[model samples]
Target: MKRYKKYITPYLSAFVIGPLMMLTEVAGEVMLPKFMSMIINNGVADRNLAYIGKMGALMVLTVLFMAVGGILGAYFSAKASISFTSDMRNDLFQKVQQFSFENIDGYSTGSLVTRLTNDVQQVQNVLMMGLRMALRAPGMFLGALIMAFMMNRQLAVIILIVIPLLLAAIILILKTAFPRFGEMQRRLDRLNSGIQESLTNVRVVKSFVREAHEIEKFSRLNRDLKESSLRALRIVITTMPVMMFAMNVTTLAVVWYGGNIIIAGKMPVGDLTAFTTYIVQILMSLMMLSMVFLQSSRASASMKRINEIFDTEIGLNDDNAKNKDKKVTEGRVEFKNVSFGYSGENGRKDLVLEGISFMAEPGQTIGIIGSTGSGKTSLVQLIPRLYDVTGGEVLVDGVNVKEYSLKHLREGVGMVLQKNVLFSGTIEENLRWGNEDAPMEDVIRFSESAQADPFVKTFKNGYGTEMGQGGVNVSGGQKQRLCIARALLKRPKILILDDSTSAVDTATEAKIRESLYHDLKDTTKIIIAQRISSVQEADQILVLEDGKIIGHGTHEELLKTCETYSEIYTTQIGNQSIGAGEEAAV
Candidate 1:
């Protein structure tokens, strides 16, 4: 919370003024009862019209002040709290953006969304409530208690008895309420996760006719959230009844004792009236404070969740890089005995890629062919430093990948991932993500090279056409080409395509490969493909199996020496004997 001082400092005036204005409202509220008592005991009884009119005018003036103060308090509180949370949310988002793939794996996407939206909102709401009442509640209680004692000390003693009882109840309720609120937030996370998953893959769900299953899952999550919310709220709501009961008992005690005193002509009726009002005020302030506490309990849970984001140490950063100023110049990528695995609990690494070693010189196309889960994607991912190698060093241009700053390193390499993703925007805008300042000429040129230009122009808006979220508006082949076009716009020193052209037809795929080789001769290219034909013309081919490269050579060389490569080639294109003509001549 102390770390939040910077956010508050910017809105310091609002923070200060909000509470002060609330105290002014409290000042008027505490005095209103006294004014009413004066009008009842003095003005009415004395039969003086002038005094009554004057007192009535003062009461009106006091109410006017209270009205002004309350309005100012609410406005400033909202201004300050909203501004505070806005800054906090931005910082939280920035921190999330800094997270490497490994760090992100620690949190669910739904959990992060909840932390940014729901959790930040909870803290903002509580901050607003607290600003309005944090000081006012105590101010009213103290002011009312002082007035009650001044009116009659004996009656005030009854308040002291009920105060402890109310305090005990509030404490007990809060104890149970905090943990329940935490559980409620966790349930909310689950609901959000379920919703996100179902909606994001809604096409799959519909294709498989799993709508009923998804609905059932959502209903269960909804029910769980509802139940948890009720549990948290039920405990907090109990406080209101307990406070009211205490207030009633205390009021009755005051009236009984004060009535006896009045019968003996010991206290004036005006004073008794004021004393009773003060007693209510005191108890009401305590209730207000208790409600603040209850809100804070819920907000505390949210703040804890938010702080988890802030507290997360980003596993990937260039802070300690020796060559932070260095850029990837040549795109000469080399993996030297690299072994990588996702770290599990207690820092255990189950290797996905074992003893991976290769080198791709600038202007060379390296083809990585492997079965599913054979770490083809894993090897290339290390190039962009998406995940650091767990065992050995990955080098680019003779410098260790870790030595280069992430911004410069990633800027030099372009990757079109296995799953092609496009955002909700115009087609041109999505393409511009590769290079924001790229000219329209460059955009069209690259699109042509990726074989996307023709189909893109077929759309009514062409490049200006609005794309659905994740490019749902386009066909799979169109999406793949668009992704490839986007990557080419980067004009990076190194380009990695992880089965990016899988959806395109063989002719179109061949055209794309031809374009890559022709257009990006200076840029190092690494292609991971399922189809053997896709990488048959590559400068070098690495055949992988069971997390190891079992064969490495040119296509013809592999056919002669490598069994795995031959099997893949035979399975894909049929065994066309390269020596059949020579055998026929013999």
Candidate 2:
């Protein structure tokens, strides 16, 4: 509700316009009854055609005014509703971006997308419909009742009896249907999640011959959504017929009671006719109110879902970090007693890294070799503050990473993930992602150094060739080289490659590495790889097992001193023996 109050000024203006439109509608309804009474009591009784013509024109003019008021009210109300929803969507998108990894992991991507798109749209529709009808229904109902009582108080009794029964039926329907609508929304989120997952992994699904299985799963979820929707509709469908039946019975009673009054000379024919019309008007208005209630019920459910995201406070805050006189520096990283676990409250039994310590000076390369799930990627992610250390601290350039502004920290580091992703754009456009203002010459230089220039030159448009979504148009090796080129464009102080060269051939990998070592002599490099040959030339190597560093030294030093490093090297490089002197020569 507080989130709703933020747009109060616009809503208040809409509320004010709604009543003015209602007043015009009431005036038009009021004039019809008076005109009918005049036709019977004055014009027809005295046979005065001129009086009937004059009253008929006045009624037509009143209707015209009502139409104009309705148009104006609709225009303003729609504008307010659309503007409010647009602002809310922007706010939600920005809020989602601000959330920490912990907060983001709590909600599925599909669920957040549904909340931003469909849920917000549902609420906006309710606001538009509620503004247009909420005011008019009550005004029409009460004004008609007042007019009916003034004409003949006895006939108005039928409306009093009928209105209460209608109200009870509406309340009963709402109580049953509102809960079902909320359940329907939850089911929709699940359906969206399934579709998103399947689409993202379409190739895997096809490779496994699971198309039929996926179709069946989607059908089951679709059926659940249909069932929930039908249940809510069933409840609402019961109310309309019951209300109409009650309205017809009330109409019959009014006619029967008014006939007796006419015969007893208690009411004129014209007044009885006007009285019946007002009774119909009141019942119709009540029906409109019931419809408004139904829409508001659905909107209420959607609002609760939207507010859940809005109410969540972002977990990461840099408010207390020093912001004064900060300067970006060449990357020199150190980790001291750093321990981390993915589980927040489940203790450190599932720790990814335990009591880890390491150091990498500027212009030197550190190789990280580990088995799967050994926290290699997790270790490098700490440098860029992707996730803050659960215990101890990671330092860059001798200062704690947490102490630096996120903007400066991220700008000084470049990373290429194991799973390479690319956006849809030309080759040049994608290369410019790392440094938006990189010169054409720098782009070509980095591409050639990464061994991506050959294939890029093969395209008719060369650097201007379009890549499909996620660079699906390119082969795996091409994507890897392009991602490396992107990172090189940043000219980062710290460059971390997490198995980025796996898809390329070893010869190309060696060439790229040789070029990188020569070009980036003043930059810090960290390489995570499965192949020992990929990292054997590094200044230092660290071998990890089960989230703990078990070996650290140069290749020759580790081969002589660390058993784990030797076993892995022998397993990958085979039993062919090479002297330590010969190994260093490569």
Candidate 3:
């Protein structure tokens, strides 16, 4: 919270002025009853119309002032609270932008979304309520109490006696409510996760005829959220009744005692009348205070969740680098005894990639072939400093990757991931995401090289055609090519294709590879592929198995020297050979 002092400091005027105006309302409210008492006992009792008229006018003026104060207080409070939360949300988003892949892996996507949107909103609403009532409640309560005691000490004692019991009930309920609210927030995350999964995969759910199954799963998550929310609210709601009951008993005691006092002439009727109004004001303020506590209990949970993001020390930083001023000038990549693992909150001692070492010369195409879960993506991600190596150093242009700033390092590497994604925009807009200032001629040239230019022109819009979210309007092969075209716009020093062309036909894949070699000869290339034919012509091939490189050499060099590479090549060729033989026999 102290870290957020900068955001709070600017709103100091609003914070102070809002409550001061509220105190003005309290001042008017407290005096109106006393004026009524004066009109009743001194003016009305003496049959003096002049005194009654004057005091009556004063009471109306008091109410007018109170109304103005309340309105001004509300205006300032809302202005301050809304601006505060808006700034806070902006900072939270910036923090998300700074997070490395490792920082993101520690939290679920749904949880992060919930924290940013729902949780931030919860805190904002509560803060608005706080700005309006936080100080006003106590001011009204204390002022009314002082007025009551002055009128009749005995009657005020009754309110004092009931106050402690009401406070105890509220404190007890709050103790239980805070944890329930926390549980409710966790359930909301689950509900969000369910909705995001179901909608994102709606086509699969429909194709598999599992719409009914998804509904059942979503219904369960929704029900859990409902139940937790009800439990938290139920506890908070119970506090109001307890407060009201205490207020009623105190009011009764005041009436019963004040009646005897009036009969004994120990208290005047006007003073007794004023005491009851003060009692309502005092008790009602107490009730308002309890509600604030209840709202705050929930807000506290959300604040904790938000602070978790703010408090996160960026996992990747250049402070410890031996050469902080180093920049990646060339694309020669070398991994020297590198190991990495997905670190969780608990910590990680074992690595997903162990003893990984390799070297790729500038402008060389290095083919990475591996089975599923063999860490092909993990290996290349290190070169871009997406994830830091745990055991050894990754060097680019003879400088350790940690030495280069993240912006400079990442700008030099262009990666088309395993899952090709295009945002919701025109095709040209999506392509320009890699290089916003790239010329139209460059865009067409890269698209032609990716073999996407022909189909793109088939659409009447050409490059201006609108792409749906995730490129759902386009076919898989089209999306892959578009992503490749987008990457080419970067003209990065190093380019990585992690199964990015798997959906394209072999001929198209061959054409794209040819363009990568001949059209972009100066750019170092790394291709991670499942098919041997895809990487057979690479400058060198590295075969990975169970988190280790089992073979490394040119295709011919590996076929003669490496058993792992031979078995993979033979199995594919042998299967195709038998199929060809059977066709000839028929």
**lDDT per prediction?**
0.93, 0.86, 0.90
Candidate 1: give the clashing pairs: none
Model 2 steric clash pairs:
none
What lDDT does candidate 1 reach at residue 398? Answer: 93
Model 3 global lDDT (CA atoms, 0 to 1):
0.90
Better of 2 and 3 by TM-score: 3
Question: In model 2, which regions exceed 4 Å deviation?
Answer: 8-15, 324-327, 344-349, 575-586
Candidate 1 ranges with C-alpha deviation above 4 Å: 575-586
lDDT of 1 by residue, 411-492 (tens): 9999999999999999999999999999999999999999999999999999999999999999999999999999999999
Candidate 3 local lDDT, 1-586, one digit each (tens) = 5876777789989877887888878899889889989988999899999999999898888899999989999988888888888899999999998999888977778898999999999888888888888778998899999999888888888988888888888899989999999999999988998898888889899999998999899989999999999999999778878888887888888899899999999988999889999999999998888888889999999999999999998999867777666656679999999988888546844677999998999899999997899989999999988888998989999888988888788888999998888999999999998899999999999999999999999999999999988889999999999999999999988999999989999889999999999988988899999889999999999998888998999999999988988998999899889988999999
Q: Report the error of model 2 at residue 36, Å.
A: 3.2
Q: For residue 523, give model 2's deviation from the true position in Å.
A: 2.1
Candidate 2, residues 278-344, lDDT tens digits: the string is 8888888888888888877887888888888988877656665675246446789999999876745
Between prediction 1 and prediction 2, which has the larger TM-score? 1
When summed lDDT is taken over every stretch of 10 residues in candidate 1, the lowest stretch is: 573-582
Please report how far candidate 3 places residue 58 from its true position, in Å.
2.1
lDDT at 436 for candidate 3?
95
